[model samples]
Target: MTLSVHWRLDPAAEPRRSEPGAWQRLPALARDRRVSTQNRFDYFLQVAQAAAQTAFDGLFVRHRIEADESRIIAAIIARAVPHIHVVPEFPASVGSAVYAAKQATTFQRAAHDRLGWAIAPDAEPAGREAQADFVSDGDLAQRLDEFLTVARGVHRERPFSFKGSYFEVENGGFDAPLNRASFPRVYLQGSGDAALALSGRHADMHLFAPASTEALAKDIARLNALADGRSVAAGLIQPLLVRDERQTAERDARDRPLAPGTLVASYDEAAEILAGFAAIGITELVLEATPTLEEAYRIGQHLLPRLRALTSAARQAA
Candidate 1:
């Protein structure tokens, strides 16, 4: 099977020097402090295009609370990038699933045949309160289930209805022409039992967060079992650190202790690392090669070739 590879849109994974956060990194690019907004956008476009060239199947973009919207950015990306799929996280609780379905179709206009919907099923109590304008505290799990029902229902040729604890939709359907893939694939990221079970029943893919290798393995197994016979891609998000050789990788890891992250050593070592992940049933990898553009290019140029070469082999062996 072909392994699905994904990368992020955020060029600066670490907090910027002027930003308030635990760790800060200054930009090392040749550009000066007098960077214009358009210049910044162009820089990101450069990295994005590089990622596209490197053969990432998809791109993930995180949503900023009220400040920066992800849908607009995703649509723009869909237009710029040729065929790469874009999955932007939407807080499902923010709006009706019907709204999300229609919105997903509209967003697909730009990315047509290259869009997937990744939803944040719920938020912490404090965060939910802040979004009182959008969603409220309730059985978010049930809400998520209802959402999946409504979304899938609307995408079908026949009208669909649902009666549930949280949502009720009657004869709901979409008339707009769908992307080549029809409705965008739905994805969810969460580890709770409710999340896992619902994801098994609804999501085409389940996105995993950073965790120990062993932890991720166990979660993948549980999700696979929960999915029964249905096909669902299991994905992990990792930040990688790679080098030409094992010693170089080790030295870099030591030099940047805080950012050591996942060490992908030589091409052979990288293949072995990927093999291990595939052995544990990971079909998708969404990773950050580095926080800055330089590191992004370095990893993209170096490790990407190895990744592309060996992922399918590893999966076949598994």
Candidate 2:
């Protein structure tokens, strides 16, 4: 299987410190006063251009309450960098399914089918309240299921009708050019049974949190079983820090503990480790690093080539 590598595009500036809650205390007004909108969009464009130039397959624009809206940013970036995919993470609870599908359909036509939908569960209660999304924890999965069902239904077929526990639509769908546009690839994230089941039914890809290779393999197996014959690609979202030398990598790891499931190593070692992950059925990887722009060039120039070579060799042997 071909490996697709995507760089994480976080609109917020890198934090000064990694301590918990360090970045959350500042008010939105305080942060906005520091940077202009044009500058922020410039930064995003530069990152997207770098990722596209570096041979990466896509950019995964992360969702943040404090930052610019993900869908807007994704649309702009996709327009700026037409070669690579731009997958935006948005909560399913944010808007109506039909409306979201209409927006996605327009995006797909404009971007030439490079848009991806990374559907996120509603995690922030206050944000949910602000948006008037009253979906409770118990009904989150059901709501997501109905959301995708209706969204896909309207996008693909005309005169679609659906009545679910959470959503109801009668003869609702697109027409002509709108219906002709391709649907965005759906990506679902989570490790729970409900998450897996939802992905099995709707998602083209299932994203897992960073975990050990063994744990990821087992989870992929479970997802495949849940899919029950449909092909759903397995993916991992992990932080990576690679250096030219082993000692430098070790020191960097000690100095900056980014997150769990982080891979810190020299270029060669990282290639070997990541190649092992591909061998075990990880077809896609979303890797984040500090100062993402520079890291995009770093991984794209050094590590990705090595990993690609290894994966290619393995595939040939198989």
Candidate 3:
């Protein structure tokens, strides 16, 4: 299978969108007068547009604690890049499943089949509990099961209700008939046995963070074995830094002022390393590029073609 690539977007962290005076400070926008509220938004849109024009198969927009990242950009990404899949990482507990399904369906109406979802079981993917005063330490696996069931149930376009440990719906369905394209492709990220089992049941893709090659191989095998024959795609999401020379990339990546644990190597080395992971079942890569837009364009314009060429050559030689 071909490699499926995805780019990450952090509305809260990228310099262009995060700095208070970023709009006036940007080289291109140095003289522009934009409102404070819309400044970050415009910058975010610009980066999103740049990403959409890249060779990436889709995007993975994170959901943060205070900021509703998914909601803030889901509509914009859908309309802006209606061709590629726009996947918003959503917290499983944020809203009721029925409501989420309806909301997603409404979004698909505007963007067609460009809709997809990634579920972060915790309020934060870092395993931090939500800030709610009433509820904490909820059953993540149970919530996921019920959430997916309800989310998929309503999309059948028939009035449906569900009774599960975490959710309840009564003859609930979308007001308008759901488009067949509204049934979203679901992706889940987890490393534990329980989480893998949960994903084996529902997720179309299982997103993994970078780990030692040996440990990751075992996890991949376990995930597939647990799936009981379900075809689940394996993926990785990691920081990417690529350049022409190995030494230059190493020196530059290790010295990057903004990030920790960055990948510093030529695109060829990165592709070769990734091919090892791919051999063990990882077929997708979600790259978190530093300096966001500028670096994203750098990779898209320069590294992607070279990486593809190297991989194709290696495949032919094999």
Q: Highest lDDT among the candidates is held by which one?
A: 2
lDDT of 3 by residue, 37-130 (tens): 6655566666677777877777778786655467658788668665767788877877678878878888877787777788865753344533
Error of 1 at 243 (Å): 2.3
Cα RMSDs, all models:
4.6, 5.4, 3.3
- The estimated TM-scores of all candidates read 0.81, 0.90, 0.87
- TM-score computed on alpha carbons, candidate 3: 0.87
Q: lDDT tens string, model 1, 1-318? A: 667777776634443422333223458865445432333445555556777887777787766564346666677777887888888777766678778787777776656668887885466788777777344455676777788888878777447788887678888777646523368888888886767888899989898876667988888878888986888888876677767788887777776644334655765676567656766777787767555456656666776677766765655666
Pull out the clashing pairs in model 3.
Answer: none
Looking at model 3, residue 138 earns an lDDT score of: 49
Tell me the whole-model lDDT of each prediction, alpha carbons only. Answer: 0.70, 0.87, 0.75
Off by over 4 Å in 1: 11-40, 133-138, 176-181, 211-214, 246-268, 315-318
**Clash totals for all models, in order?**
0, 0, 0
Residue ranges of candidate 3 with Cα displaced over 4 Å: 15-38, 121-130, 257-261, 311-318
Tens digits of per-residue lDDT for model 2 on 168-284?
889989997998889999999987777888889999999999888899899999999999778999998878999999889889788865777788899999899888889999999
Residue 163 displacement in candidate 3 (angstroms): 1.2
